[model samples]
Target: MNLLSAGLVAAVVVLIALSAVAIIRADRPGGAWGRRLRSRLLLGVPWGTIVSVLFVLAVYLFVQRGYWHWTDPVTIPFRSWSYLYPTGWLTSGFAHAGPGHLRGNLQATIVLAPIVEYAWGHLPQERGSQSFASWRTNPWLRAFVLFPAAVLGVGLLTSLFALGPVIGFSGVVFAFAGFALVHYPVATIVALLVSSVISTVVSSLVDPIVTATVSASPPSAPSWAGIAIQGHALGLFLGLVLGLAVLYRREGRPSAARVWLAALVFAVVQGLWAVYWFRGGGTYVLYRGVGVALVLLLALLVTLAAVASERPLISGERSLIDPLSPLQTALSLALIVGLALVAYLGLGPPFVGSASVAVVITVALRILYTVVVRIAGSGRWAFGGITRRHVAITAVLLGVALLAGPAVVPNLVTVGDDAVPEGETVTVEDYTIAYGEEVPNRMVSAIDISAFGETTQINTSGVIVINEDRHIWARQVSPQQLAYSGAVRLRLGGVGWSESVVVRREGWTAVGNGTAYQVWLDAEDTPTQHAFDSAPQTATPSIDGRTVTVVPDDGEFYLGVERGNESLGRTALPEVGETESVGRLLFSTERRDGRAVVVAERGGTSVAVARHEQYR
Candidate 1:
């Protein structure tokens, strides 16, 4: 719609054109129309998977148009055991938080799925191989049915340990990468560099330009957001293991061993680096000097391995350079250096070290292949037809894709309208509580008591229950219970009770309330209530003993002063969630139920405050 979007669209058009040309050039010439059609349908395009995913995406978008929270029906909630929405395990993969999310996953699926399907669908027949001659072994069945099943299965498995609601097909994409690595290792690595690593780099570089032109916010740093990296990592791990097993059967034990060793080394180094960055402690530091020592160690080991493995056995005719051409060696070296640089600068410390290790492994593999050829003295060494032209094309496409990717994709442009019904009320005994107009099944109620204590009065209100179920439950503060403020704490039924307050003796406030609560139904249909507690008090004294109090009132805070009585000046605080200061005293608030807890501080010293009590 805007200049930035339009530019992105243009870039996508160019990419499509290039892809179409490439596909056409790659197509073989000697096949019948029907045979070619079938081949293209089954292997080239992955029509079934693509169509099904697209259909689901369309439906999700349609529902989101009317009911913004439509994904709630399909979201795989973190740590939830409830099988109430068993279908969500599969459906969540198709659901996305925004258009940008949808486009990113969809693009990845389009690019990677067909390649994986083709590789796995038509396995090369061996001379003395015994095959399972059944429907289960049919290549078509494997491509159409088994592939999707694996994707969904991996998606669901990864969601179990996700820190939050898991959605999108990123896990499946990673699985595709894993599978591709075994069958088409060179191509897959190139794709990963271009698609995942390079694209991210390009996106960040161009974001400022787009932001300036279109008056849009700058894009976030290239870190996983909303999408679960853990899920992707798990899928990749499973894919690697399965792929290795499959490749072992196809390529013999020695070949499989070499691949496994290379992958294991890479995985270990990368995993260690991640641990160092995220969870390193004293032991980690002692063993690896934080991350610096680890990186240096990795470099040493990789260099040694490369040198030892590539040494010329008989000099002259048996040298490492004899089998490989100078161009190939140069290209390999260039790629290694380029990739390592990108990994270090763009992806940070962990990946750079891993990339260096990978470079060594790749070089060692070539040397190992040459040695085997020399020993056997029969078969020619396999280099898989890598050429300067192919490298050039891949680089060009990677650049184009990175530059124009965001322009063609949709992003979260606006917040969706509230879909919750308005004026929803429920009666608990004689008292009536109002459910939040924007969040369904969330109740908030308030009651004022004339005499809660010997000389105090109280006004108490907050969220009683917040759940994702039909029946809502909350603690109803009856008029009779006002006399028993601290003595009789009423336990609110259901889950997710917002902060409720007990205002005692006018000025003295006791703001004890529950944080945001949600009830998760486990696989056994048992419900577990999860809630946090609001902080204790609000106002703090400044250098001059003046205090500013911000009280939570139904999603908004009422800012007031506690200076010399003066009837406690109360006014509506700004909607922005920022700490406000009056003179030397600073005031802040956090959401509790629908209300807020006012946190006040002065001169960095905390002030003790009394809890509010209701007088009957």
Candidate 2:
């Protein structure tokens, strides 16, 4: 069967099994499954938040269907001044790109938001009063106010410095996950694992169908892919900080310290992943895998720490055995080493290096804090009851902030004139030249090159690089590259050049006013340019001559064809390159001082020569 049919069959089977299981446990008293389900529905369902999220999803779908233009209104623009707009700042968190985006974030919100809300909603009021009369003493009121504020606040903060217009509730969802990590660790892990598995299975089954049907949908709808990872990272960091503060307020210094340590470990892993992602240019799959592994690792450690500290909390009795036993230390070191190895092999050396450095810095800071704590004495506060613990926590937080904050800079400041020695450069008789500009345009910038005694002016949409002495300018189309459709139009020497070509069902069409040309094989499998206007141009199977040249009508011309039937069937002349010959007839296309010259020779005599545009 095909992919769709197989997916349908699998889905049906899963549904039937789930239904049967539900039926089996429906009326059973003291049923573990039933009780667990009930607990999730009751305790883990933040009704107000979930309802608001659903409403937002509904509006998103409506907007996608052309009910209104919600994206621009809600999306935070990539400008520092745009943060002043409260509508976009607040609504952007709820605004998503598409259905797929909504699905992933909505599932996360449903599972994690409730757990976060529950944690915040159940905290004991001071003076042993669990009253709802005063907002200050009401956990539910505080949760309702604080959770959404955190979501919008962090979302706005991230979007202000984002590389592009930021939308979607992913940042908030990550924030929820971060909060759940500290408060309801077991439930959070279960939810995350189950959700991840389900999402993977669904994506695997549905991706083929979606890919096949994507052409049917309107292109106006923005893509749901390319998650704002920087925003998510910031949200996660903020959530951890918030969780640390809350844990300190409710549970004691020790619990807060354990949570802080766990957060540090997680932050280190995240920082390493960020380094790999932003600096090392790791793939999305590798970044995601490392993220999952880090979360699982953190969950395991946090759970163990919680269990170890539980006795002290309950009975006020410290364990006789030291917490950092040799075996435990060895296991922790082994785990860290194993993770580093995985990061090195799976991601890259940069990740491993960053992680190692981060770990060392963290360790040194911890040691320094310990020394200060010892010097200050255990019972005495350093200043006004602010002990070394507070300082250590602040230092750890600052370290984490430093690590996560810099990752966003690469995304934001994408345009700069940073010279690279890696690119290919050609040294002519009078000048040295490169294909593209050294600096990349984040949105749209001018390509100004003063090489070969000539000034070349072109509009660049992104990082334009010259290749092999050819005037072929290439740029990476990223979120930073194009702020909006048609935001930047590339032009070369006052003539507009198309950035892309289109292939329709009818035929292939180049999307520019310039002459479209290609090399292909003919019906008889002979390499030749038979008809210039044919839909599928004939391509010669073999090259009878060693070199071929194309003479242009108006622009500069001369193309070198070596070892093939190279045909430029365009009215425009080709640029110059190195010279070569098969027999006695010499053919060369050379550029000197911003000028292209095509020359032909036979029997050691110059046959024909052409000079195009002159250099300055």
Candidate 3:
């Protein structure tokens, strides 16, 4: 199950468990509240869905109609995933481009969400005795208002300017997941657990299986996969911060200065959102930009809470209550995240994925850094040159960097005429020498293509799109050369060049456009079509030659010795007695004796060699 499914299941179980436990024994405090909960109720607009759809549409228009108007989902990611932000930071969330990505997110939302809405809608409200009207606001009102805004805002902010546009409601769904954690821990835990099971299908089980079977895995996630761990991390982090923050502010007293600091950040974020809003052209664009504003509001609240409590350095406030007291803060965070992750793992559909355990650990470390930094300083806020907390945080970040593995940089090395070795890894950091020839245009942005002679499996990928300027050609060189002979193969730093299969010249002469393309052989039986406009003056290419240079003679059209046509068909074997003599495949060859066959065409006839293998 993914986080969503886990959450859903846990919600049901909790609703039932709370009742079951109550039936057997006298009610505990809040037992009546539990009794009132029901499922399948919808309140408010499907605001989340509407927001999700708008983002999907806006992103589509950006890709389809925006200046960089290459509307293809694959290419948006192709340019790079990290660069997707400025063009769409907000727009990525609006559209599904396809049904599958859309349906999956909707299922998770609908299934795992009822408990949350019910809990929010039914929470007991505080009443004003007789003066004003009574408002049905629960202790959760602060959390409800701020949580979604924070999650959406943070996720969008972090993921904006990512490699390409992404679509899905996971961010908002997760926001609810975060809120559910605070209100209904048991239900949330169960939901997360189920979600974990479903999530495994994509991350651990399904992916690895296909990869192992194909003997392959891609570098980084695909552009269209809509997997936003970074955004998820931000959402999860904010949910955690807000859950504790709201209670800390309400239950604890904070100084006024800290509140102001929080307000300042809010204003800044709002200004930025407004700028984006005006720049965006449509209703969808405006709505997405508003999401950024909502995010700013949440950030402001967190800042205020932080300042009011005890984090003097951030809010420039003197804490009246030891900055929210470390224990309360920890409890608040634990109270929310613990319940949420559990439900996500238990009952949510597998679509709600989790980060690496290492990353989760990183979250704790980051929180610790903030805590230590606040505690160690006794003097004025944030002006210290080097506090113990800074040192600790630095140490942790540096450690993570060191442990993450050096990102590999790729370069091509030629062994000989057409052979590049495989399985060797190199980083761009390792290279110092300059280029001998102009580097291939494709490699300018780090695309690596080591192409070869034949064009078999190479043509099958939809990823290989063709515009007018694109063309494919054969790469032929010997593996025998000294330069590439010692050179190594590529590995995935998960970005840029480095292919799974290395092309050796001795293999079928595969083809590519020298750059920006991936090529591979689909058949070994295929002939090496060495087409020429005219005859070779002699056998110009010799075994001893390093490169065979071909030139056309004036009006003297001739080709090398007889061989079946290799260019126009997918299969290597000719179609029984088929010939390329006519413009189409309608003409067939008639076998006369045995050596060759006579090809009958519309106006006349041509001959095709009947190679022994094709005789049947």
- Please tell me which predicted candidate would have the highest lDDT against the true structure: 2
* Candidate 3 whole-model C-alpha lDDT, 0 to 1: 0.33
Runs with alpha carbons beyond 4 Å of true place in candidate 3: 1-87, 111-152, 161-167, 192-228, 247-576, 579-616
Candidate 1, residues 1-616, lDDT tens digits: the string is 6677667767866776898788767774335643654553454456546654765476454533313433232221212222233433435555555555665666566656665665555332333432346665655665566666766665665443332235666666666766665566445545544456535634543452443354433222123222343455555544543443344334232233334444444334334333211111101112234334443443333222222222233445433434446357546644754464343334432344435534543454345434433332224343323322223222322222222121111110111123222333333332223322113212211111111121101122333332334222232232223223322222212121211112111122433321221111111122322221223234444335555554554333355566565534555443336666554555555554544444556667644222223232
Which lDDT tens digits does candidate 2 get at residues 240-319?
Answer: 55554455345433344545455445445334233122211212223546655555554444433333321222223443
lDDT of each: 0.40, 0.42, 0.33
Which lDDT value does model 3 have at 553?
Answer: 32
lDDT of 3 at 490: 20
In model 1, what lDDT does residue 586 have?
56
Reference-based lDDT, residue 264, model 2:
47
